[model samples]
Every structure is written in structure tokens, then in C-alpha cells.
Target: MTALAVGCPYPPCTVPTRDLQPIRHSELRMDTHHRGRVLTLRRIAPVVKLTARSWTVTQESSSGGTERLEVILHRSNHGQDILESESMFMVKEPYYTLSDQGDPTLRIDHPSDLVVCTGSLGNDISCPSSGEPGGAVAATAFAAPVTNTAKECKDEGNAALKQRALPRALAKYTNGLQLVAKDTAANGSIACDLHRNRAYVNLLLNRLDEAKADGTASLTGIKDQEHQDLDAKAYFRTGHAAYNLGDFQEAKSLFEEQQRLAPSDRDAIAYLRKTEVRLHEQATGEYDFRKIRAGLSKTAPRADAASFDRNTEVKKSPGRGHGLFATRDMDVGEIVLCEKAFCVVWGHEDEALTVMTYDVRDDMIRGFPAGLCKAIVQKVLNNPSQIEKVMDLYGDYQGIGKHLIMRDSGPVIDTFKVHDIVARNAFGPGPVYSGGPRAEEDVRNASTGLWIRASYLNHSCVSNSKKEYVGDLMVLRAARPIGAGEEITHSYNESGDYDARTAALKTTWGFACTCALCLAEKADGTALRTKRRALELEADAWAEVEHAAKAKRISIVKARCLARSINDTYEDVRYNGLPRTALLRIRKWLTEATTRDLAGC
Candidate 1:
């Protein structure tokens, strides 16, 4: 609910200060203390002038009292302002309280409310800089004679590539291509090398379409009997682009061409084999899942070999956005779909990957692994072709226009949109284990990934389908028999009671679930609800001590009694065949206890 406390302060501002009119007013809510009261924040002050990013202003409140608002703007490296507004409003009347003690802080909660900076003083204000942004830089790079400029750009791009500065490297390579003439045979060698090298860089950056075009041009520019090795390299690069774009058959042909040019090229041979595997998986929805899982410890592709989606199709749902539906009848326990993650972050060894980020405006704290947001952004930047697949996903920042900041080197991405998208769509870092049950701490730091198609499967308390993760692959299976054209659903929050499930869904996904199970639980009498809560708590307590009791071979009657109590709470007609998540473990415990007692007799 406040500005970022961590950062290297900008070199002292020499620019003159002018009156700052509050250009925006973000609506506020304090969920912990407001009891669902939405407050509309209106600025009564005409203007406030300050020399720094942080300023304090006196404002007239709705209650006709003076309120002091302290606004601090933290300028991110991506050229967006993280606005922290702390308002201490005067209270004239008793407001309905959600807490016994009052909360003085007010917050703006959405990313769109935070201003996109042209030059750091929020939007609509520009900071003074020494040079014209991208134009001046580009002009200077091309000022030299065309041939000399081409050579200079090629050398600079190679150096940047070695340093792993991808965007800078891409800019240099592009500059070289602009100056080099492609028509003449005399310049063909230089042009060929430039296109081939640029294609390689594009492949590294995941700009597959650009890479494919450049690779094709590199091959075309080669005169007969000139650069046999270059031809092989060109084919290899183009093959990869096609492979990544899911054109496996074309990729196979390209790789075979590369092999014909250079039989001993190991990289080409390996990728050719991979292409064949992808072709096989594409034809039949089958894979060596065991091999894929075992390969998790080694460095491998972030995407799995194939996306098996033959059983489903995306179609419009009534109230919700597009949802995944079964295209054919599927039996219970049958695999419905298997897809690879678009991006994922998995912690190593004892590393706790989850990082907590404070959203000052929203007064919300969200946590994800440190590089997860950057990973997604970089993935999109590398392959601008896939930008729509990511941007089309549901987010809080929809309808907000361009946030990308143009820079001399390349476009500086605004990660706020990606951050919001990940928060809504990602799954993992818990309930995912490679082997046996892990400690709670290990489970908390597990792995997380975004599966675009999987996100389309909406939430339901008693879902028709269930999802499991293996490496980066998301495997969806029908929990109950699903008919043709049936919309598949999965429980978003399966661990909690009715209230907890509803609250989690509303807080995390921004929707109240009105599924059959949720509705039934809501209409359940108050007495029954109270009894169920008490019984669930008792079962939890028993679970905590069950392992220790089992080591001592203690009587299992309490486990049996707890299981019975849980089962009785769920009505037979309403909850039949639906997963009673609360009762599952208890029944297992009772079964184990009965087996042990019988063995002793």
C-alpha cells in the first residue's frame, strides 16, 4: 500500500518544478477494514507544486474535512511510475467497521491507474534529456560510408551478442542489414554473412518469423560454389524457426537439407531427431512421459515436445469468456488435453523462488518467483509473433493502451501488464512434487508455469475435469464422463471450505463462483454449516497428530468417527460422485487403520 522502498535514486534533478495538477483519480477499497465499501476518491485541491517525485497535498474530503495526502512516485527502469498514495482522512462519523482497530491507509489497486511516464514525472510530463531519443542514435550509426557502417555494425553486433545483450545485439544486426546492398554479386558474400548472422541472433531471441525470413534470404543470396558451410548454417537456423512455429514437417525437410549439406554437424543432427519426435507426437497424442519427467533435472526445452489438443476446442461460454469444450465423448479418467507451458519458473535445491511484490495502488500483495515475469516478457519480446497469445489472456489492465517505452537500443517493455496476466492465469509452486511427499516448505517453493489453453478451463467447485503438471506439461483428464460439446471445468481452489473457496476465487480471480456445489453449500442450513466447520476442524487436528499416533499404533476409532462425521455432512443426492476434498484423507486414514487392526487379529 506504499511506494517501493528499494531502488537506486535518480541523479539529482536539476529541472525546474511546476504546479502538478492531479491528472488521475483511482477508486479505492480496503478489503481488510472496509467491509466491502467502495470509496470514490475526488481531488478538491486545485494544484500542488514540488521539486521531487514525492509530494504532500492538502485536500477537502467528502465529509467536508481537510485530509493530508502523501504521494510518492517510484520510477521503474521500464519507464512507468509506481504511484504510492497515502491518505490520512479525517473521520467525522462512525463507518461500519470490518476490524476493531481502524486502518488509516487508502490505496489505488490496479496497474492502469499507475501512470506511464514519458520522462519520469508521470504521463503528460516530460523530463529534459541531452539527445533526441532513438532518431539521433540511429542517424549517427548510419552517418559513416555505407560499406564502413555495415562492417562497424556487424562487429558491434557480434560483441553485444557475446555480452548477452540481446536487444542491443538485435538493433546492431538490423542496422548492418540496412546498409549492405543485397543486389550485387560483389556484395553478396558480405550480405549473405550479415543475413545469416542476423538470422542466428533472431533464433536466439525467439523471433522465429524474422529468423525464418532472414535465413531464407541468406540461402538465396549465396552464389553457386561460394560458402558451402554458410548454406548448412542457414538451413539449420530456418529449420529451428519452423520447428518452434509448429511446422514440424517443414522443419524436418529443412533439417534434412542441412544434413545433406553437412552430414557431420551435430547440432543439425540432434535437432533433426527432435523434429522427427515432434512429428510423431503430432500424429498421435502419445509421448514417453516417463522420459520427459526424467529429463527435468537436465537442461532441456522450456516447451514440451507436443501439445495434444485433439479432444477439445475453444468455444464461447454464456457469461465467461471462451472456455475449452470436449469435441468428442470422453470416459472418466481419459486424458482430455495435454499442453506445454508458455513460460515457467522452478526453484532449484532449497531455493524459495516465490517473491512478494507490493502493489501500492491496489493495497494487495502478490507473490511469484523472481524471474517469472521477466521470463514471460522476454519470451514475447524474442518472438513478437506470440504477443497476441499472451496479451489476449484475461487481465485487470485490459483497454489500457500502449505501455511499451521506445528506447535507442530497443523497446523497453512495461512488465505491469504481464505481471497482472501471470497473477490471474499461472498455476504452481505447490501441489507439484517430482517424487514422494515433500515438506510444506519445499512444496511452497516448488514450481510455477503458465499454460495458455489450460487457463481457458474455468473454475468450478465440483469440476468435471482435473489437472496435473509434469515438468512443463499440463495434463487434463476427465474426472467424470464428459459428453460431446460439454464445457470442461476444474476446481481453482480445492483445499478450502465453501467460504474459503469463494473468498479465494473472488480475491485471486475477481469472480464469485456460483457452481452447483457452492450454491448448495450456501443454501445449506446455518446449523449444518456450523456443524460441518466444527467437524472439518476436528479432522484437521487429527491429521496433524495422526503420523505420531500411527508410530505408537494407537487406536484408530477417532479417525473412523471423524470420517463418518465428514461423510454425514455432505448430502447424498447433491454431493454424489463429487469430490468431498475435506473427507478424502480421513477415509484413507480409516481404511489404513481397519487394515492394521485386522492384521493384528
Candidate 2:
């Protein structure tokens, strides 16, 4: 827990999906006479300042769908358990600013960005120019290739791959692929070629399944003649990787198809024969490819959970407890983090189980299907310690803002805690619908689940990030360019007048609003209270208006209604468009930001 040895000096072969919590280092627990240097880090404004020594940083992409913007210190330690370390704190992209930083020993930028200026290679930092920190020049395997602007990126990627600079190659290939998405050329040939080139790079990186997937992507829109050549190579590379992965049947099919296309590819024929043999062995239970399959590739759109942006980490802020912060420069639309949902329960039912209360026997947990209720409740019933873990989350659900007089049975507590966690941190189970806004009825009808790590992000009315549920994953994309060391924040309430948002935050999640918009609107007062109390106040106001109307006090009724309408126009100004407007805005902003960052515009 004290010191974490940076484990990957040589880089890892595969990038595993990281958990947001502490990474396990039990396997790294070692008793050694030679101890690696310990690099202790300290935090300043938004940068994790290196107080120990001036260390060089590097940017490299891994086939595991992660890009390591910085490296860790390697150490030899005597321990027998996983080394619990804090989230990595550092900022990565837009390192161009460091080009003039004039410190050779100190680096505020990644080495890859200084390749043209810093003509050196190794672990140490170096800079031959003013304000430029340099260590190892990025891989330049092949001399730069001259090609049309559309093909320029892929050609650069090819050179990086020859240099064995897998990460840099990926970035270039990805850049090319992005351009292809926007291109409207004949038969989409350029896009196919990009996929085919990326597939080859992935194959070299040992990402077999991703290579196969990319290979398949290359086959789309193949009416163009240029793609015909790419198609054969794509299939051949995919088959070769699949063969190594023990996916013999798939390998066989791909290899056979490749040979048919090339007609004279002896390598494809040989691989096809080997695949047939492996398939026969598999059919007879002579081999188990599970272990190999597990390491094949990560095609999912997330970095490892333990993986943080070079400048991202856990820090404590007063009032809100622990939250995420940037230690370095991050571009708008950067992926700060991605987490898998710890629990993904949707349409769960609890109709038969209700908590007893005064005036009412119990509150019906309706809208949830009966089958889902049993399944979820059973999961809790089977797990004895579920409540304690669930309680570790923000369980400020003062259910009805009243004391729960229900019996202390474990299942009942499970229901209460689960309800609290869901209310505070859970997002939807649908794509886009998960974290995006929803109608009150649509929310009740949809499924919801919790992603534990993402729960640490605090609320901001004028948030800089977009938190969305994309399929089973919770993604956090930067909405605006974030400076290093700045806090990462997202909106938890709607774009509306302060009072209504405050009430929702206070009544539902049990929190007060202090974000910029809230403070600007002078949102003061504890809006937290019973849900029914909120309804009661609204009802009382309407009742008074109704009474005045009946008594012929038309002026009073009109004044009250007009005041209410005028006070609630903030929402109309922000989101009066169709529901899809929010979705479109998110897409446009994110796409533009990403393109700018990658293309270095």
C-alpha cells in the first residue's frame, strides 16, 4: 500500500481492462537485494510534481485499447499481497507546449511529440532545444512515406510499426480511420484500406481478435478495385492471428477465403492446413483454448480500469469527500475514465415487498417486473455482506425523509441499501439513455445499474464532462478542454432554474447544489426534504390559485401563474429543442474535440 513499483518498463504485451479500484500486485510482491528506484509524487495545482527527480514521460498506445501517457517507477519489494496504489495522476495530450520549456533534465511533455527535435533514444530525458524536454525519440521504423493527404496517416503508421513502435502506429492508423469515416470516396475503398492497415498493426501487437475484427471491417464496401488487394491481405493477417489464438475454425475459414482471393498464396494454404489440424484436436477435446482466447484482444472502447490519464488521480475535496482531478493538461473530449457497472439491474420488481409506514401499510416498489425483483433480491439474499458494500456508496436516501420502522431482516436492509445506491449513483442500462436525460415515465420504464468507480465524480451544473451509459459501460468524455490539475465534473441535474434542480438534488440524492450555475442563480437554502413534502407545497400553491379563481379573484390567480411560468424559463432557453437535441449536441462536440486533438488542429 505504501510504495508501488512501476511494473512496465519494457511495456506489457497485452493491456487488460483495469478496475477503477486499486490494482492487484500480489504477483509483483518480491524479496530482492536489488530495489528499483522509488519515484514519490506530490500534487500541486493540477500537476503531480515530481519532487524526486526529473523523469521523462512517453506516450504509447497498447493493443489493449489503452494509451499510456506516462510511465511508472519500477521497484523490487518484499511483500506477499497486492500493492494498493492511488490512481495515476498526470496529464497527457497537447504536449506541444513543452517544446519551448527549455529544460533537458525535466520533461513536461511526452517523448513521442519531440521526435523531430530530440534525436535520441533511451529511458533518460534529453532536449537539444529550448524548453524541449527529451528522452527517447519515438520509433521511426521506416522513413516517412509520401502519399496523398488521405493516405498520409496510414503510411506514417506503417513506418511506426516497422520501428516496433506499436502504440504510435495505432494512433496514426486511428487517425487515418477517422479521416476515412468522413470521406465519401468510391466504394469506401479508403476506409477499407485503413481498416486493413490497422488490422496488420494489431496482428503485430498480438491483438488477434481485434485484428480479426478489423479485417472483417475491411471487407465492407468492396466494390472498389483498390480494396480487392486489401481484402486478401486483411483475411490473411486475420487468419494468421486467429491461428495463433487457437480459433482454428475461424482461422481455417479466413485462410481458405484468403487463398481463394490471392489464388497463389502458399502461406495461406499452409496456415489453412495447420488450422484444420487444430480444429480436429479441438473437436476431440484435445485442447482448451480458453486461456489463449481470454488474452486475444480488447475491442471495447475503454482503457483498463486501473489505468488513469497520466494526470488523473483520487484527491479529497472538502464537503464532497473524495473525487477525481487532473494533474496535467487534458484536451476537450479526452476519455478521463471508463468503468464497467458493478451491478446492472433493470426492470427489477419488488411488488410483493413494501416497507410499512404510517398512514400507508407499505410503499409499493412498482414498475419493476416481478421476475426481475426475485432475481435481484435473490442475489442480495444469497450474498450475506451485500448491504455493507452497498452502504459504502452514497446511501443518503432518507427513504421518504422519515424513519424506517421495518423489521431488521437482511433482505429488507438489502432492499433499502440497494435502493439508496441506485438512487445516488446508478445510470440507465440502455445505450445513450443510461446517463443522458430521460422523461420521468421513460426513466421508470427503463433499467438502471451502478458503476462504482464513476460514482466518485462530483456534480457540476456547468460540467466539463459528459457521463453516458454506452451499452454496458459507463464512459466519461471531456466536454471541454480541461487544464492539468483541474477537477473533473459533470452535471447531475437538468439545465433549468436553480430551485427545481436544487429540489431534485436535495429530495432525491440528498445533496445541495454549489456548482457555478447554482451559485450564480444564488441558490441558497436546504432544498432537501421529503418527496411528498415537495408535492404538498406545489399542491398548496395550486389550491390557493384555484380558490382565488372560484372567488372571482382573477387578478391574483393570473399573477401567481405568470410568476411561476416566468421563473421556470431557464429550461426553455437551454433545452427547448427536441429530446434528440441533447444527443446531437453531445455527438457534435465530442466528435469535433476528438478530431482536433488527434489531428493536432
Q: Which candidate's TM-score is highest?
A: 1
Compared with the true structure, what per-residue lDDT tens digits does model 2 show for residues 306-419?
Answer: 212344676786788878887667688666665545555443222122221121112222222222222233334333333344455665433322222222121233333344
Q: Quick one: RMSD of model 2?
A: 25.5
Give the lDDT of residue 175 in candidate 2. 63
In order, candidate lDDTs are 0.60, 0.44
> Relative to the unseen true structure, what is the C-alpha lDDT of residue 587 in candidate 1, on a scale of 0 to 100?
67
Candidate 1 residue 291 C-alpha distance from true site, Å:
0.8
Q: What is the lDDT of residue 121 in candidate 2?
A: 22
